[model samples]
Target: MARLPLTILGSVLFVAGCAGEEAPGPGGPGGPPPIVDANGVVPNYACPGSPGCEKAEGPLLVGVAARPITPVLETWDDLDGDGVRGDGEPFDDVNGNGEWDGVWLAGFAAGRAATEIHDDVWSRVLTFEQGDVSVAMVGLDLVGYFQQDVVKVRLEAAARGLDFDHVVVTSTHTHEGPDTMGMWGAEFGTTGYQEEYIQHIVTQTVDALAEAKASQKAARMKVARGEAPELVNDTRLPEVIDQSIHAAQFIDEAGAPFATLAVWGNHPEALGSDNTQLTSDYVHYLREGLEERYPGTTTVFLSGPLGGLMTTIRITGCPDAAGVETCPQGTFERAEYVGKGAADAAIAALEGSGATIEDSPSLAFRRRSFFIQPTNTGLALLVLTGVLHRDVYSRDKKLIPREQQALLSLTNVKEGDVLIGTELNGVHVGPLAIAMVPGEIYPELWMLKPDGSSYIERPEGGDFSDAMPETPIQAVLPAGVTPVIVNNANDALGYILPQTQFDDAPPYAYGEETEPQYGEENSVGYTMGPTLTKEFAAMYGR
Candidate 1:
């Protein structure tokens, strides 16, 4: 899960111990591996006439997994046989009858990669520094990026010698996963058949980071949070979201929770959008329920920022309970009673959130880069007013005229290009912040609380701000501090706009009020949730 910040930290959200460094204790396997040493990955080498400061020596920890992998490339028609598919090169199998349709399917792709899920696993995490600052916690999987493409994956983890203070790239928004994205959203992973499944997903993330770095060890690092709210649900609408669970166990020496980081939000898509089968949904029921209730832990799922969010479902149509296909638009026992209540609320947030350990002599992880402002009108102008293209999200799912999305935004992004939006404001291993905002947001701006004047402060309860309470943690730290609103995860724009509803007002008003009525797609819209939190604390300076 890598960029777009719609929401779904994981589900939509992993370590060990000592000697040759054998970890297992903490109520885990047989028990006893938590020693600690060799911590390296330094690289910040300051540039552009540097005054001087090029840090990077060791004690780093990096992880990655960029989800969305539903590969089904090739289907054809266009030049408008009127059979449908936006019109033209529509991918090209042209009814030779190979199988993808006159291609009513509309979307299909597979190009983009920089995968490295676990090459040397914790990539770097052995911290020792006590004063100034040298924290650690690096993991990525991405989703939304029209700016800084996750700062080119954090300058490729600081050109390989990382120096993070919370580089949490958690995403599993598997709308069948793949297509790190190339404009017109949700087109689904491209191909040469994804070149051997993206080289077997970067060789199983570099062989699970060389088997978790030949299996590192040490221990202690626990933190628990609660509120499973019957397995998180809200799936956006004026419904505002954020189902708080925020765990991060990581223990050894006798404590427990070998490695866990749950994080939450909604919309692993629960397996629909026409699924072609190639899943991670229910994330193997959260890695077989955290390996049958803590049997030598190692679970990592970080999804949130579910832009317009979803999942208080319980199965209203298809893909219920991980089957991958359930349709009818609404019904399947409410999606299998909300996918068996988000897998029994992620196994009661891992057997009731008491998982302790963060031993901290001095643990820190730093990453900084803030500057976002591109949206003559979001979605590069709805794809330059083509009204949200990619075949209008595959055949008219809805919207096609800002003058026809301005002719695909006059040919995609130019006239002063660049929209920054990078948010990962981390701290206290909680009260998190992971923005990527672009479109679908308006679920009451996720908590809308701006007062002192400047926009949405209207809270007394009667309309304006204060609705998003499905479970939005609230961590929001960057400048001063205070953050938490976990949605789908990296870059999934799609919806979000709460400045009193825009588009020349009248019909709904300010920031374009509860969108979905113009064409009727359902699920809910308009934009800007996470309650605009001081306009994202003044767009990330906090």
Candidate 2:
């Protein structure tokens, strides 16, 4: 397959001042010079060096911490079934005093209120430090987290004197969690996100970071990869599934497990849409299974490139918690089955073929902020109507003040005039290279054969048929290194697929009789796939 060149120059910045060059003074001669991209914007870096660059001094230290972030439910029952909360709507008289009170469950559809708490959701953090540089990876059990909230977590951490070089806040994309992104409210255009609940999440996240930082201890690392395709189902045509599970296990001096960071590409929605109970879905079990396997060890689960709608929905014949062979969808049994199955796969890979890194492996990272043009009218309406609370940027990457957002309309704004500001992060810890994507990426964008060919073929009728496949993320990294592509890392802009496979307009691709596939409807726009792939490849100077 032909690869697309790095054409999105403004989105990527090259590292200046190579190794052996005189380190500039603090604030003058010895300090690092400002590195700018093609657009003349300064990019953030963990160290003053190239991509995956590191400056190690002391032994590697690792710590893990978690805090419950379940929201206190205050929801109004939709009596009229109009998908809107109104004055006449009845409240849960049994649970409360006939007043509206419940939490909006995100993912499948709107107005899905949480009836009960099956399991608690969490804000988990894994901290790493090898020298002066420190990085924090926060995993939240939610459908999606906006970049605006991520910024709040960073600022709060800084205020508490717990500053890290880079912080990657990711969501597990649990369909049963509270709607933090504001889309899945009681109605179609209404916002389900509660300001107080979002604040609670932010506070808990920062607390987890602080706790993790204080608990850091000297540790070693082990990296491994396993395959569990049977646990994942591709709901879209031209099926491509990322069955690989990447794990990084940290060990203390006594060889006791400190924490295990598992990365996989499957939506945590095994409980399905009709269920109203609030839970982390399969993620709760995935973490529980791992922690039980290694007592006293914490496990952090990060969702990977599950954009082509990789899920456990409709997957049958898996053993349930009671050892039953037949597990059905939308049941707690199915969720447990898939979660434990994934946990078992990771354990087998870690114990059987895990590779331990040398002591005190260097840690470094790079973060770039770029703009994605919005093409979906529904998404734009959500932003304009104040249903989606996020900062919008102009073509020049300037923030369009929220006050002025009301005045903007589809007729006034051109196709590329309005943009969404998001981030792409890359981290290197010894031989492991981690790509932190801002949304659910398609598996084809991350997985590639050794010869740089995709395992899946492009469909026949895409919007961009002549478009070349952007270089797969794994292909851009150094050879012989373990790669972990984390999706929904900093923000959730919906599905990120290849531009060549973007089929928003009919005649639909994959021979659909009517409308285009499901992925495009939730996506920000067609440019997401190309923009992310190009920027990611350029981040590594591919």
Candidate 3:
């Protein structure tokens, strides 16, 4: 743990143990009364470095709800407002089968529509309220969300008269879900987006959030952190992974647990690409296991800084039912093993870890956006050909040309100045400060590898090295404050890789025989890691 800043110590002591009362346990009664500020308005217990932390006077309130987002093939309608459905519009046979039902399952490039429904997918919402301000965190069982879609969710909720200071939407990055983003369609550059299905997600998310707010209850929070190395593996270069599993549980005043949020970094592809069922991957199993172990707890699994290829590739000693041993990777049994293993680790951490958030904890949120030049020509071609659905902005924030002809017509283009919108967010919940990444973030960008190696060598004149403790999480957060990265949060821009790795990776090729690089296949472009790290540091006022 880093050293806690002077201001952080003051803030923690300000709310520590709450006025002559013992700190409450996960299953204990409220510890102390709400502390009031000079204005008599309950002073928001803002952490030392948390920007835009909202203050409220009252007991903590939390609500948890979920809605089904499973797509009904029979009821699948026009999804993109393009007037007609499958009438010569670009539709790829993702699974390479002759028959095409126009459903592109995300996560795998071998485009396959959902052939069967293994289980119903869901959109889960966890809403928190303090005084007049409220924030909602939504988790969907999908591969990723575009920035436009992420913003649209907020806008749609607002249009429906739903009010919130912030509504953070993140896809669980489940490989088994429908292709919400257009990238995973049948063809290399085509889209399998169904507008109706997207609308269903938007509606379910808003509705669930509304119901959650309506079902608010006085709650106390307990946050604990533990490592589950057996559960996650890093497949990309430098072999770095964030094994830290952070669990935050909100216990209602009645002593019944309601909502639990867990953060980890492994890609949810435990079932691999061979299966054709619609599922939330290991996430569904993880949530089910956690809820079964602790009844009535709504569990939300968020991916962490796993951009440089973190996954469940370290398959060893996994066993299937009937006491038969299974392969180490890409099996349903492996998925269960990972999910149940994570649950066990979480239970162990929560049971004995002595980290307790206050009964009336402070809630604050901060967000900022930046632009990176699209350096990969292959990706640029996808953007130009109307294949990849991403909105590019100019230096002045004007919409850049995305159409093939328009982009081709422009001459003498400076690639670095052609901005792609990316964003980062800092959300403070009690003593936990969450750093949100819009894409899959490489763990090396935030922390140094266990072997003391780094993603990038220190620049000749730069003050900061490209390593952990120098990342957005450490730079923006005060020392001793709990920090976690919510990768693929709000928007899935793509893989945010370090500049050095980006340079080392083979050049991007749009043609049939592009050389395989470590992390560029799913990346937007290069140099995103440095840009995000700088912006995050600035956002937290480091």
Candidate 4:
């Protein structure tokens, strides 16, 4: 039997050779030496080798850095075909300074423009390194960035001399920040992606990542999760949600908090559709509250598997401020309450539980690429018109679908399904595992219902009702090792729905008229549900 080649990030690979047992390849003459060159550069992390080879050993250096990414409305397009930016431009006097602020907010599809900066948005960066290997995670305070923009940022990061094995970047999904995804532009179809704004974010993100890498110091890690079921709720499917707030705190040799990475599954939309202020919403307060509680500690919040339409419960009434049903409304005051609550939960988790803080934990990462069919007509049009541009390839790895406007569904570009290069990243630090998915994933797909049965609905070819099984993650991962899902990582291909929950077919409406499951409409296509599940399961060797 031939073993198919599996390459991770095109660096770590398993090649099927003729036979086994050779007279040792590099790394000196010490019994069966691990795969390594003369300089001791083991291409794969899971191989055997020197003191720090194939393992996350001593001087577990970790670093943190951040920089602001708030966009200033510098220019606007000539919407009316006029060369000037004076009359009939998208402007608002949000600050009440008696002048149009010229800024536009991102996230909501309601077309409400930004008026003032309520709070500063930032690009938070974290880097973990052992020996010659390094990997990073960058969290930007904005809606998601398309793969094209992400590639641009990575290229910039590399050009800036920040060399990393892999840099997993994700947006905080803040509805109050600048329009990075281009969906919530001036008008829905029209783009509000300013060249300056995009460049600003790219430059700032790279700078933050570089700074964090430079600041790396000897550290140890503590991973734990706390209950915060009340903080997160699924608007589409209330029963399916990942409410456990996970935190990974890194401490220095001196026992001082270095960096705290917290994760929760919920949309950062505390400032709702009508908001005109540029903010990070609850995410802003989440970081602030954590930093305040643990003085001198930098916190980065990564959104988890929240695609089952996870969002804060609608603030029908102001729970904190009495006598007013909606006194706080979508104000910062409300954001603070939600943010502080989540922060408190994360802090409790860090303090309450005892995590195996490993000074030398095994660190390994694997990244693989796959494709999905894009069935969304609107998104397909955007890709055709160049409004949205990402590298779309054929199954044979050719830059394809050359006839842009000709193919409405890139999924049908070739005889087979057109491949979209979506990546799956798995990183392990001792007993803790982190799965970085390219799109939004429903929690129910990874977690079972309280009744212990798989939470599934509306099956396609296979009936979901007949089920008595574990989730894909649970089935694949080792026992007692809970993998924290970080969705919208690397790329944003819209929502990754469960097969049963996918409602893209006619009768078209996802949720009930009153309860509207908007996530279905936002999905790239129906194939994403099963495709992602299968890919992840196989990637993890299920």
List the candidates' TM-scores in order. 0.27, 0.87, 0.78, 0.80
lDDT digits (tens) for residues 279-309 of candidate 2? 9988888899889999999999999878787
Give the Cα-based TM-score of candidate 1 against the true structure: 0.27
Rank order by TM-score, top first?
2, 4, 3, 1
Winning candidate number (TM-score): 2
Candidate 4 positional error at 454, Å: 2.3
| Each model's lDDT | 0.35, 0.75, 0.65, 0.64
Steric overlap count per candidate = 186, 13, 11, 1
lDDT assessment of candidate 1? 0.35
Best prediction by lDDT = 2
Residue 118, candidate 4: Cα error in Å is 1.2
* Model 1 per-residue lDDT tens digits across residues 1-542: 22232221111000000111121111112221111112111112111112221233333232222222233345444465443345444455533674433211111222222111111111112222222233232223323222123233333433344333223333344444343333213232111122243333333333443345345555455555555565445542344555555555566666655666565666554544444333444444554465567776656665544544445345344345776644432333333444445545656654564544346422333332222223333334333322222212112122222244334442333332322222333333322233433323444454433441222333232233344432222334443322444443223434444433223223442234453222112111222333334444443344
Better of 1 and 4 by lDDT: 4
The digit string of per-residue lDDT tens for model 4 on 1-542 reads 00011210110000111001111132334322333222211222231233333444556678899999886653444478453346666544444565544455766452556656788999899887876556788898877766546656655665677766567788777778876655555554565556667788889988888889889988778877886665566666546777778888888888888799988887888767777778998988889889999999999999887677787755443454554445354667777777888898888878884555666655566665566655555555555444444445555644443363236454464344444656677777656788888777777677765565666665432323233332555456556676788877877777776765655444434434433245655666666667777777777677
Candidate 3 lDDT, tens digit per residue, 235-291? Answer: 644566677888999987777788999888878888776666788877877788889
lDDT of 2: 0.75
Clashes of 4: 1
Give stretches of model 1 more than 4 Å off. 1-58, 63-72, 75-98, 101-486, 490-542
